[model samples]
Target: MAKIDKSLYSKEEWLVIRNRRRLEKQLKKQKEQISYPVKRKSSKVAFVLGNGVSRAFVEPEVLSKLGVVYGCNALYRTFAPDYLIAVDVKMILEISKSGYQNTNTVWSNHNKAYSNIKNINYFQPSKGWSSGPTALWLAAEHGYDDIYILGFDYKGLDDHSKFNNLYADTKNYKKSNEGATFYGNWLRQTKTVIRDNKKINFTRVIAPDNYQPIELNNFENYNTIHVGDFQKIFDIS
Candidate 1:
């Protein structure tokens, strides 16, 4: 690349140009860093794990044995799934500080801000989506015919008033007493994945009282099952 003639442009104009160039370079590096596993013809089942409280009683070890597992965010603190997806800067930093990224397959949007983290993989053409939906999308992209969504309660507990994550009150998370995080984005993103991947089957495992968004029911590819039945089917005692 030729040297930029900084003196030829106004300070503000130069700043914009510099930032654009920097982003382009970062995107290039991110593209190069992407590493995907070999797609197995026989690999048809996948599990996409979220941090919702409904799945608190479930063990990731049991699911890992059934298929490829992709977990989101703080799920890494407990069990390292086959692929861990975290987009939030704080959580990414926490994972990096623990040196988890050094030996694990973690994916995140490529940002110049995280240039210091050397081991994790960057998603090419970054989705800019939240971790749970991103994990779902990744699983769909891997050609899984059947994908089970675990812990995606999609709303708060206690009539949607309280925080409902398995990792609430822990590091990099809100206190259990805090109000629920908005679910609009998660619902829309999840619906988009289902719409885009019509061929893949998505079964959301929900507790009896789990909030069900009406929008999801419109998708033919999407379905839901009570957590009790899920446990019985999987023999997850």
Candidate 2:
């Protein structure tokens, strides 16, 4: 740990600094001691799992059997995908505390704040993107011929008036009664990924009543399929 000038900081600030430095050192040491397996590129198909309520019935394990699975924050509590992506600080801290990165593949933006947690891979170029779109970008980076986006409903569950998430009531998430989060950034990021990877077909699976944003329809490589139709196509039932 670097030497701290005690004279410059108050007691509470000094204590917080000391604790952060200690945690960073511990994480760095743990990273150096463990070895992780290199990911294999065996499949051309990829499934990016978003936390939208539309995909509540879809089983990640079932998708895992078919192709590579990429999931976002909080999903780790129930399912460990082929690759997990989390960019939020609170979510990353929670994941680190649980020691998930030690055994599973996790991807996040590179930050000096959490640089010592080197057990997981950091995103190149560090776009500082949201978890769902970042996961989509990661899937596109793998050169998958087809990417299916599940549970990416852009609106709230209750007719766009409330929160719409599979884990809304759980820790680190907004309550179901909370107002809907703005989807502008997510829409732009998702569109950028599709536009950049024109060769890759991007299929978004949604429920019958799920909101279909007008912006996405402009992309030639992007298309939306009903969740029931997607299930039938994949024999997921």
For each of the candidates, give the backbone clash count: 0, 0
Model 2 — which ten-residue stretch has the worst lDDT?
Answer: 32-41
Q: Which residue runs does candidate 2 get wrong by more than 4 Å?
A: 1-38
Give TM per candidate: 0.83, 0.82
Assess each prediction's global lDDT (C-alpha) against the native.
0.88, 0.87
- Whole-structure CA lDDT of model 2: 0.87
RMSD of 1: 8.2
